[model samples]
Each structure stands twice: as C-alpha cells, then as structure tokens.
Target: ILEQCYNLMDFEAVAKNTMKKTAWAYYSSGADDEITMRENHSAFHKIWFRPRILVDVEKIDFSTTMLGTKCDIPFYVTATALGKLGNPEGEVVLTRAAKKHNVVQMIPTLASCSFDEIMDAAEGDQVQWMQLYVNKDRAITKKIVQHAESRGCKGLFITVDAPQLGRREKDMRSKFTDVGSSVQNGDSTDNSQGAARAISSFIDPALSWKDIPWFQSITKMPIILKGVQRVEDVIRAIEAGVQGVVLSNHGGRQLDFARSGVEVLAEVMPVLRERNWEDRIEIYIDGGVRRATDIIKALCLGAKGVGIGRPFLYSMSAYGQPGVDRAMQLLKDEMEMNMRLIGCSSVDQLNPTLVDTRGLSMHTTGVPSDTLGLSIYDPLVN
Candidate 1:
C-alpha cells in the first residue's frame, strides 16, 4: 500500500508524515542557514545546456565505470546510516537496490546494521565501499578499515568534513533519537554530540596531512577523501597518496554558507590538471547532483563521476525500494538524453566545451591550465 501510495515526487511527503519527525529532521536538515544547501541546487540551474541537434542517437547508453568498477550508470548510492528509520528493511533494502543497479553502496560508520549483516545482505553480488569517520581512537578506526577489507569491501572513503559535526539546528529542534533502535555494531545514531561533540569523541580535530599514511598502512583498498573544498586540501590529499577525491560539503549537511560542491569542482579540477595528477587519481563531485544534466555538467567541468545522497534518500523516504529504483532510472535517463542531445556519444566525450558557462564569473576568464604556484589561464566565454 505504501509503494502504491507514493510516486517519486511524493516520497518525501509520505516519509515525513509517516516516519518520526526527529528522524526526518536528522535525514533532511542541512547545516546552519542551509544557504549552501539551497545554493547547491541553484548552481546546477546556472549551467545551461547547449543541446545540439542533427546527432543521431537512436540508442543511448548510460553505462560507465567509477574508479575501475563498472556500473549501470555514473552515480552511486551515497553512504547514509540508520536507514531503518526510514524503512524496516533498512540498509538491506538499499544494498539490494544498489546490487540490482550494479553501482556502488557506501556503508556508513554509523550504520544501524552491523557490517556483517550488511555484507550478508549484499550476497557478494555488488561493490561495497566503507565510509569512515575518525573515531575517538585510532585503534577503532583501524579496526573498522580492517573489517571492511576482510569483508571484501572494494574501497574506503574517509569523510573529513565532520571532524566535528556542524550546527544542524533543524535536527536539534526536531529532537531526534535512536534510543529504541538496535544500534547495530554499537553505532551511535544520536546526534546529541552535535558535530563537534561527535568528532571530539573520536577523531582529533588536529588531524594533519602526516596522518594519511597512518590510514594507508591499514589496507590496500583505494582511499577517497570526501569533503575536499580547497585546492590546497586537494594537494594535501594527493600527497596523502589516496586513490581518489570526492569534492563535497557533506551535501551541505556540514558547514553552512560553504561553497557548493560544483563551485569547488571548478577550482579543484584545474589544480589536478596543473599538478599533472588529473588522471593519476579519480576525482568526483556530489553536492547538488539532482538530475542527469547536473551529472553532465560535472563531467564537463572534469569529474570522473558524481555521488548523489539526498535525492536518493528523498526517494527512499518517499517509497522504499521502488522509489529508489525509479530515482536511479530518472537520473540515468536524463544523462543519456543530455549526452545524445549535446552530440556526445559517450560519457567520456563530455568536457567544458560541450556546455556554455558564459554568464558565470569564473568563466569570464578561462580556467587556469597550470595550478601549482603558477598563473592559470581563465577562459572568456563569448
């Protein structure tokens, strides 16, 4: 009845009314002011597609690989914890959907289901990546990474933005709690720590570039540092010897009024190219990718792929598995259609030249070709 009761658009409304108000707040609220959250969506609007006709795209394909793993599309189901709050099946249902879609599933450190349970649900049929939070103790962090590696998890994504949790006033006001939940693997689903208290409990806010090797020594799986917003940080990540970077601001769930992910993408990509690490490491963006066009825009700006969090959550909250499936299909369809319309036969062909960024300030001067201690040539769009 619930599945039939909601369409993709109606998922959020249904979830909000049916799910606990506090859980909804935790899942939906952004950082203070949500200024960046609002801007993340708006930045996509600022990019206009210059779709070219005369191209024969009788059949469109949305198949691509992320960081050497093949997928039905370019997007991944981002790691979010305590999905049981949204639906009884919890991460199991989400794992099944990602397995079915042939994409990646990031299992959060705060997952309500234990790693063993989530892996059992995966059934060795899909790629699962572990998302890490710097726990209060380095020993615990290493233990989680080792566990993930032992379980055949393909990669590790260390989310660095929340060394301390940000001020999510909405969630605080809504008063969410996970007291009754099983709290799998001794996970802390409560945000009572806030961002600061939470990180303070675990990761040292003073964590530095020197610590990257500390994590590297733990496992051979690829490491992707998420929440990289600055070029200097990007350089630090590269120096850290990680395999990839996911330019994000935690879906604007961390810092308020921070630069949207796209804005950061434009800045970081050139640095990668100039540093001669453009293809050396996988680069991805994930803040405001709500549509296929948004995905294409990121590719044009030089991202290997994009990670989508809230939109899929919105779908899951709205209609469970079916909503999740429908949302993935919509994004894939949009990407394929936009690619064909823009005369690009494949995702690989997408670049800054395919779309016009004439009105944006950064485009007024062409983007720099060299990034390290050198002047970059910012291009002018006519």
Candidate 2:
C-alpha cells in the first residue's frame, strides 16, 4: 500500500499508473467531446463558502439520512459498471468496503459481478440500492427489479438518461487496437462497445414519465429517477409520484454539453423551496464529486446526499479493498475539518446560506475540444 495517497485526486494518479491503458480509457472516457465531464469538476470552483465563527465548533456530525435510510456520511458509493476491469475482485470489493463504512452502495445494472454475487458479499442488513437502465424487455426489467426488492434492496434508481450508450471514441479505439482472439467468441463478436457496454446494449430508449407506475407495480422499493436534469423535470418527477430523484447527467457519459449535477442542484432546490416540495422527494446528485467541499456545496444547495463513483473505482483499481477503505476515511476526515471550519455542527445545519451559487451557473472558461490533447491529457493533474 502506498502511504502517500493523501486525497481522492491522488488515487486517480495511482489508478492511472496502476491500471492498463484500455481499462483506463473506458473508466475515464466521457461523452462526445467530454466538455460536461470537465465542467462537472470545474463548476465546483464557482461556489464559495460563507463561513461563520464565534459558535460551538468543538463537535461536528456529518451523518445523514436518504430515502428513509441512515448513512454514516452524506455520500453514497454511486454505481459504476464493469468493476472487474479495475480489479479482479470486481464489485464485491466495493460492497465489503461500503458495508464497513456503513455507507450506501448503489449497485449498477451492468456490474461485472452478478446481482447475487454483489448482494451475497454484503454482511448483515447492509443497505444497497439498485441502479437500473430500464431494459426494452419489460418482463426482464420487472424480474430484475422484483428480485432486487426480494433480496433486501432499499431503493431503485432508474436511469432516466442514457437510452443509448454514447460513443466513447477512446473506448472504441481500444477495440480497434486489440487483436482479438478467436477462442473466446470468434472474430465477428462485434467488439464495438469493448467490455464496458458489453451487457449494457439493451437499454430502452422509450422510457418516459408514463412508465413510473409500471415500475411501482412490480416492486415496493423506493423509486428514484436517476438522470433528472432540469427543475421542470423535477416537478414532473414529483407529479410522477416517485420517492426520490437524482440530479445527474449520467456522470457526463450520456450528454456532451449537459450541465453538471451541482449546477442543476442550485437550480432545482430554490424551486423546491418555493413550491414547499422539498420534503416530497429525496434528491441526489452525482458527478464531479472529487472532494468533501464539493459534497458540502451540494448539501448546502438542498441535495440530500452526493454520490461518488470514479474515485473509489480508481482507489479500488490501484490498491483493492484497503484503498477503498482509506478513500472513504479521507473524505470523512475532510468533512469534519471543513464543516468545523465553516461553523457547521451537522449535516442539517448545511443550507443555501452556507454557500454562494452566484458563479455556479457561469461557464467562464470556454475550453475548445482538442482531440489529440484530450487523448494524452491527464485530468487528474488539474
């Protein structure tokens, strides 16, 4: 174990150095020109904290509840697919780490490990949520949902974005570079999606608000729409009668120029407050959650909790289970220090007043997409 992985970004460098290039491209690649992916991280720079003093800051509690579940922290291990590519132990490693931290883990539908394998890895009544890419086959989707509920899953995060997987050219380039072996599935196996989207091609493009009730009928788990982008869609989500909605752009994997999750959170919360609908549903945002302050900003903007995906995968990829354990601990430490410095004693004390989102919506740096530069670029250094 390297003792110097001081923060989340440190893990990225480790993972990049540790993992194979093909796996790195798949794990790191965003949609189209990856404009939104970069923006997701950069947007957090816009929000500034309003710290207070002359108050009791001796103790700080960062624990919070989401979708009627208690979590040790306000961040969940958001779903990411094909964990085996990162480490041979696959998603089960993440499951054990989440259980240890008492943090919720949202299991991806396209996980390298089977649903049973991932759930079986859990100890006791460890809460895990399901991330569904609604299949075209309604029966198959229903069976998957109901089975998840039967196996003690608490929440259903239906991915409302990514009807079709975006063309990640870097990932595609890996396929082109590979001299595939015939013993596996033959030369005509159609390796266009490489391994990441191997099992993800069945996502139904026609999923809409009308299908919410159909999902409700099949399972009793709290239904959370995972890719809601705008305030209007959030209002529609409330009208659709779901239990929660995640403000995500599919981790900047589905759309090219879509707004970052925190940026959208700033837009959504004020409306929820105006309509007095903040209590109607739980709201979560994933993407660009690289640090504790980013998580704090999202919490201040009325997000129930933020989801962190890539960093854990990077840590797990580079150092396995121990890496993930340390990654979670680092965030917990940062949260305590930052919350105390900002004069916050608990997660509930975090509000819109704690942070200024005035610059959150502004895109000051217009980064023109340079294909070759992006190909060799190291975003972790930034």
Candidate 3:
C-alpha cells in the first residue's frame, strides 16, 4: 500500500501541504512562468517507449558507477539544504538512508547536519559529495573544501549558476519567509536565517568560469559543476578539467524561461562528442525524473547517471528514513523492471535507439501526442 501510494503521488503531492506554504513555494517554484520546468517533464512525455518482449529475466543488476564509485542504482539523491525543513533529523536521515541504499548523497554547505556529523552518520560510507557555493571569500570556500576532505567526502560539486538566489514567485506568494526554521547554522536556531548567512558568505557575486581552476588547485577530489545548460558551458567545464557536469536547470527551480535539462541534453551531447571527452569525463542529470523509465530515458539521451532531489525529500517527509529507503528501492526496482521489459539487462545498454523521439513537441502546453512524445519506443505517424 505504501509502495502503491508512493508511485501514485507525483512530485507535487509529496511537496504539497507537508511544507509550510512559504517553503513549499520557494522550493517548488521555478523561475518565471515555469515553462522550462513544465518542459522538462513534458519532454520526457514526448519520448515513446519501445519495449522488446521475450527477454529472460531471472535476475537483474541495477548497479552502476558514477565517477568510478559503484552503487546499487543508476540514480543518486542530490544534495539539497535544510532537510530539517522536512523532518527533524534532516541531513542525518538522508545520509543514513542513502548509505543503506548504497547510493551517493551530496551534502549542501547549508546542510542542517554539520559536515562532520553527517559524515559520521554515513558510517564509513565516503560516497558523500559536498556541494560548495564558492562564495566571495576564497578563504571561507577553501576552508569548507578542506572540511569536506577531512570528513572523507568523496567529491565536491560546485554550483556555478547561482550567484544570487533566483526570485521564485511561489515562495513569494506563500507569503511566508521561513524556508529554514528547524535547524540552526550560526548563532541562530532559525534555518532560514542560517541559510541566508551561508549563502551570503559563499555566493561570490563575481564568481566566473575562471574561478573553477582555483577550486581545482585547492583539492584533488573530483569537481562536478551543477547547473550546466548550454553547450558552451559544457565545453568550458571540460576545458576547466571538471570530472563531471550535471546538466541541470537547477531542477527548474532556477530559470523559469530556461530550456529543460532534457532539451539541453540533446544540445550538450553532440558538443561533448565533439570534445571527445566522453571517455574522459562523466555527464549526468536530473529533472522530471519521476519513474524508472525516466532514468532509462536520461541514460539513453547520454547522461552517465541521474540525480534525484524533490522526490527523495517527499519520501523523507512522508516516512523519514524508512520512507526514503522505500523510495530508493522503488526507483531501483522500477529501473530493473523497465530494463527487463525493454529487453535490456544493464544500465549501459540504453541509448537513443531504445526510445523514439519522432513527432514529439515539448513546451508548457500539452504534448502534441502523448504516446509519440513520451514513449521509450518512437511512435510511428503517417
């Protein structure tokens, strides 16, 4: 029954009502009209599935690697700040569940759990990645990097796009300002206040592409830049020696009018091929990835793996760590089930050929043909 409900509740329901109106607005609201946000999911709807029948499936393996670290599934939870906003234990719950599921869980600098505490919670599972905001003060940013290294965090993911947080109308309309109220960061017990301070210190208004080298100089742990949407930035990331790039529109929480991460994947992949860096680095993404088939589509489209954010939070909010475990398990199970149905046995086998993109148009409005647009197998139209 829990599993059924989990599958039935889309991303919105998991977020609705549980979060205070203000926090919900902020976290759920995309940039402008949320055109890109809608498109991200809409684009997925445009692809049709062509599942091959008659495949033997006595056993299946959903395990794969990201930055060479083996994991139980092809997707991992992205680091989002203020878990306490959803549950009291906050980051601790997420870390424990992630460890149990054998997946990487990145911790935001604004994480409610102190870096050391969260690290300890992982119980020697160093698959955790630390997200650095790369604030104005290099000293502070470098210190956080060192802290992550000392805590055994496996990698550093620098969010390059947000110099200043975007204006989310939903949050504005929520008519409240307490996005982070449960956990304390500095002298304040208010998570929202702490979040404000954290972002203020680390979000350097002058941050630029050149600054990535400075981060590279400070730590040898692989650096992954999140929020990459354009091909030029992808090229720049490769030139900067980034180990990976998450093609994201900040989960449609950043740019409302921006292109969906899925739409951008098409543009980014060819440039990546041109760079001939496909063999040298990893390219992963997460946006509108609500089902097992969504994971398969991302992989087929050229993502090395996918990151899950809001959905995991929804699980955590609904049932704490157990619920999170269930969510992760369901995703892995769905991936396995979908893989068998499609006549593929592993994560690496999915590609453009597995799904059809014909006659599919994506936007905020409804798709031209639901089957044509969203099927794993391309739809045939006469």
Ranking by TM-score: 2, 1, 3
Ranking 1 against 3 by lDDT, winner: 1
Q: Give the worst 10-residue stretch by lDDT in candidate 2.
A: 179-188
Q: How far is 23's C-alpha from truth in model 3 (Å)?
A: 3.3
Give the best candidate by lDDT. Answer: 2
Whole-model lDDT per candidate = 0.73, 0.83, 0.72
CA deviation > 4 Å runs, candidate 1: 1-10, 179-182, 185-200, 359-382
List the candidates' TM-scores in order. 0.88, 0.91, 0.86
Please provide, for model 1 over 298-317, each residue's C-alpha lDDT reduced to its tens digit, 9 standing for 90 to 100: 88888888888766676676
lDDT tens digits, residue span 47-141, model 2: 99998887698989899998888899999999987787789888999999999999999998877788899999998989999998787889888
* lDDT (Cα, 0-100) at 124 in candidate 2: 95
Q: Candidate 2 regions off by >4 Å?
A: 176-189, 363-382
User: What TM-score does model 1 achieve against the real structure?
Assistant: 0.88
Each candidate's number of clashing pairs is 14, 0, 23
Order of all candidates by lDDT, from best down to worst? Answer: 2, 1, 3
